[model samples]
Target: MIITEPKPFEDILEMLADVDEVSIIGCGRCAAASLTGGEKQVLQMADKLRAHGKTIVAEIVSDPAICYLPRSKEVIERLPKNGAVLVLACGAGAQSILEVNPELLIFPGTNSRFLGMTAQVGEYHEKCTLCGDCLLHLTGGICPLTRCPKNVLNGPCGDCVDGKCGISSSPFIKEEIDCVWALIYDRLKKIGKTEILSQTLPSRNWAAKTYKPQSIELSEEEIKQRGR
Candidate 1:
């Protein structure tokens, strides 16, 4: 799941300052799960805007999600072209809306946190970086790229002490985190798969981390075959 947090209301107000009329879009998936862009949140935001003297031209909580281009297009078509749009979803959903109509004025209502795994209701943990590479099998399912403070692939850095990672310069990982390589070693040892750690992995393909837009066109026969 993608984790998101609502942008500060003051910041939102600043973004919408120039606009007198606005349309709001919510997500029924991740944003809903995070309580950042659900129906309730959308309604609440609309009320806040109205109280602030802005006219609400449209409000919608998109089913599935606005990240789905088809749904974004559908929602965008229903909205008035005269008003600016405030998307209460992840950056992907907001971008999808822009893809549907580049001319539409779009504003993000939530700041994306990370791609995460849900621990429980209202709880999430970062698990993947979507690095476009897979080394989990060799590392016993722990992702060093995501979990390790330094993103060390081979093993813990020299600064590591005990089972904890070294302090990182990154603001996000400033606190000493548990060393993912140590966790991988312990997990592999417990399962009698320690030999897997002996082989050194090649340098990661950093280029793979960049996002590249994709398009696939299938013939009618190809599309029909996929259904089977």
Candidate 2:
């Protein structure tokens, strides 16, 4: 699951300030789970925009799995004849909409948050960092990348107060807390293999944390061969 919070209304207003007519687009898949940019949210946002004296040309429309499917074109086609769009989907969905229709002015209505798993109902936390490598089996399925505040691979530092990370002041272990490491420890202890924590882990690749646009290229010959 992907978790996201809606961007501030003030910021949204500023982003669409120049546009006279606005159309709110929503994704029914992931955004619906977080209740951010789904049908309900889009309608609410449209009403809010109307209250702000903006000419809302149409009601909100939500598509199922807009990010992975090409059906988003239908929604785009239904957008006001000549109005800006405020997309309420993940970053990928927003980008896809823009790619499909470059003429349409698109704006993001929600922040692209982390790829996470639902800890419980209505509670989602990041579980993977997509670091180009995975070491869940070695560490008992606990990803230090997302679990540890500092991305510490070795172990919790001395500053860990009651299992909470000192760096971010995040609670270490709560009464119903879902600490992946703690869960792994408990499982290992039950299996009589509690010494797994004693094993040292290799240093993490800091390069993975560096922000860089990764791209793949194909030669002209290859493109021609593939009939591109």
Candidate 3:
């Protein structure tokens, strides 16, 4: 799921400095799971905005405001003509609403964090880095691109001390973080695929990550050619 965290209240207030009438937009999917843009958060934001002397025009909860253009339009229809929008969803969600109505001033109330998996409530673990090249088949399903601090693909950095990553820049990984390569090594050993490690990985093609977005779409003719 997409992970998002609410921006600091002070920053949100600062964004609203120019707008007096506000419409709040919340998310029912990713941002809801992160507790940053759920129904409760929307109401809380409304109350706070009211307290701050802003007229609340309207509020709507969209599951994935990013993917649903018509629903975003419906949400916008509830707002007054002069109201500005304060989006409590992730960056994508806020942008979705803006795309629907470019004339409306929109402010993001949350920061889009990462593509992550929801663990226990209030806890999210980063999974895919969208590196474009997937090596999970060779790495026992563990993502070296995301799990490794160095994003190493060939092998371990040779900095493992007792199977802990030597990268200590992350303050959250107190003491030591488990070495992703070591875990891959152990899992490969158990599965009798240790030989897979012997093969050299191709050098990464970073153009996919830096340039134009890639899409997988089949044309109508191509689909018909398949005889489906």
Quote each prediction's TM-score.
0.87, 0.78, 0.88
Q: How accurate locally, in lDDT, is each candidate?
A: 0.86, 0.74, 0.83
Name the regions of candidate 2 deviating beyond 4 angstroms: 80-82, 119-121, 168-183, 206-211, 215-228
lDDT of 1: 0.86
Q: Please report how far candidate 3 places residue 37 from its true position, in Å.
A: 0.8
Q: Could you give the C-alpha RMSD of every candidate to the true structure, in order shown?
A: 2.6, 4.6, 2.7
Candidate 3 per-residue lDDT, tens place, 78-151, comes to 55554588888777787777667777788899998999999988999899988888879999888888988788
> Using alpha carbons, what is the TM-score of model 3?
0.88
Q: Which of candidates 1 and 2 is the stronger one according to lDDT?
A: 1
Which 10-residue span in candidate 1 carries the lowest summed lDDT?
207-216
How do the residues 1-228 of candidate 2 rate in per-residue lDDT, one tens digit apiece?
Answer: 667779999999999888878878888877877788777888899899999988777665556566654666676666665558888888888877776677778888999798997676578778787787798876766787777656777766566545445554436644443444555666667777778788898876767457576544799999899996
- Residue pairs in candidate 3 whose N, alpha carbon or C atoms collide under 3 angstroms: none
Model 2 CA lDDT for position 18: 86
Each candidate's number of clashing pairs is 0, 2, 0
